[model samples]
Target chain A: DAMVIQNPRYQVTQFGKPVTLSCSQTLNHNVMYWYQQKSSQAPKLLFHYYDKDFNNEADTPDNFQSRRPNTSFCFLDIRSPGLGDAAMYLCATSTRGQGGGETQYFGPGTRLLVL
Target chain B: DQQVKQNSPSLSVQEGRISILNCDYTNSMFDYFLWYKKYPAEGPTFLISISSIKDKNEDGRFTVFLNKSAKHLSLHIVPSQPGDSAVYFCAAMTGGSQGNLIFGKGTKLSVKP
Candidate 1:
């Protein structure tokens, strides 16, 4: 019911292997975001898409990239997954309408375990 | 550097008591602050928020207080219940940014009934 969804609740990839995580939202919001969360740490912004306009965090590594092929789908691609990259990936969506900036709705994150 | 910081890693509260969660930030540029509650294996849900211009905001049993000078904010829950036990994260939004929130590590609250 109009919520964000992430595929493969859990993922496993070996060192140096490329991995892709997908996110989609039924909320039909114009803005979508990707965040990486390590255990017991804050969720860090990796990048975001505002209707296909990509905004990457200044501190985010180049190895991480995102593509929003369409309104409902956004993908996070890790060129070479490392053991250090193991963490939960979260997706969120929001719309900046009349009232201006609103709260973001997050999806149950995908826990990635790199082998 | 962590823009938002929840110094208290964990807290315990007695049932039906007031739960006060504190958050501090190093960035004076942050103009918006939010509180999110999360359960294990689940995503965080927005609880409440306060803008830098306002000193306080309230909803139902929850309230948020923002002190712009100190770069500190607080969330208060009255008559806390056991179900309130969960991880609470404090986040901040920089000026001119859309919905980008810099989050704190989180504080785990245990409400004992």
Candidate 2:
């Protein structure tokens, strides 16, 4: 079945170290997104790729970056991991159109722990 | 300010009963609303959605009602099952190219058998 997949469901990294989380989709959607979710908080949008164009949220920190090498793969790279950055990272995909109300399909998410 | 709001942090219901989850929004520009179900250690899955043009949409045992004038929407689950226990998140989107979803703090529902 077509679905979103994330690698390394749980990740541990030292503070100030760089880490990367991966996401791939079989749904062939045109849009891919990355979100950061802290405990008891709403999933905050970090960035997204509309096809090949990257769109970053205004409040997203500089430590977080995303790359979409192709339609099926996207990666989130944390330049400097911080204790506060430890949270569940989610990846989602959607086919743009239909008044921009397309339902986004999400992956299981990667839980990052910064030590 | 939160564009979408799910005031209830948690709810408890019995199996075979109706589970009602309510959501409200402060953004008048929001034209589409959706409900997502999330289990622990997993990503949220799309359950149901309603457009601003319509007041309600239903699929199987799940129904979503939208009150555009009041900026309120609700999800109703009939004959709620234990498997239905999860976090329900209310999300809203405006008609645009970005298609960014504004999510509310999720409500955790516990359906006891």
Candidate 3:
């Protein structure tokens, strides 16, 4: 089945350590997104790639960065992990084809824990 | 600032009854609205959506109503089932630079059998 996959469902990193989360999609969607979700809160858009063009949220901190090497893969890198950075990181994909309003398909999030 | 707001943190309803979830938005520029259902340990799945051009859109048992004037949208589930119990999030989108969605705090619905 074509779906989005996130590596390392649960990740633990020490404070100030750098960590990377990976996402891949089999759906071949042209758009991929990364979101940060705290417990019981809405998913905050971190950044996204529209066919290799990186678009970062204006409020997103500089510590968070993303890279999309190809259509199927995207990575989120945290320059320095902090206790406040612990949250669920979600990956989603969508294609803006004809009849536009495309719904995003999300992958099981990567839960990050910063010690 | 929170653009979308789901006032109810949780709601419980008997099976086969009607479940109504409400959402409000402060942003008048939101032209597209969507609802997503999420289960524990899983990502949210799209449930239904309504465009600003229309007041209502229905699919099977799910119906979404949008009031562009009031900046309010709602999801109604008729004959609710246990499988419908999950966290429901309301998201709004507007055309801009990135075209990213703004989501509200989710509402947890519990449908008892």
- The Cα local distance difference test for each model comes to 0.91, 0.94, 0.92
Candidate 2 residues lying further than 4 Å off, grouped into runs, are none
Off by over 4 Å in 1: A97-100
Better of 2 and 3 by lDDT: 2
Candidate 1 residue lDDT tens string, A1-115: 7899998799999999999999999999999999999999999988898887899989899999999999999999999998999999999998866533468889999999999
Better of 1 and 3 by TM-score: 3
Give the alpha carbon lDDT tens digit for every residue of B11-111 in model 2. Answer: 99999999999999998988888899999999999999988889989999999999988889999999899999999999998888387899999999999
Model 1, residue B62: displacement in angstroms?
0.8
Residue-by-residue lDDT tens digits, candidate 1, B5-76: 999999999999999999999988888888999999988888998878899999999999999989899999
Q: What's the lDDT of the predicted structure labeled candidate 1?
A: 0.91
Better of 1 and 3 by lDDT: 3
Task: Give me the displacement of residue A106 in model 1, in angstroms.
Answer: 0.6
DockQ for each candidate?
A: 0.63, 0.83, 0.63
Worst 10 residues of 2 chain B by lDDT: B93-102
Per-residue lDDT of A6 in model 3:
96
The superposed Cα distance between candidate 2 and the true structure at residue A15, in angstroms, equals 0.2
Query: TM per model?
Result: 0.96, 0.98, 0.97
True contacts kept of 3: 0.61
Put the candidates in TM-score order, highest first.
2, 3, 1
A43-88 per-residue lDDT for model 2 (tens digits): 9899999999999999999999999999999999999999999999
How far residue A67's Cα lies from its native spot in candidate 3, in Å, is 0.9
lDDT, ranked from best to worst: 2, 3, 1
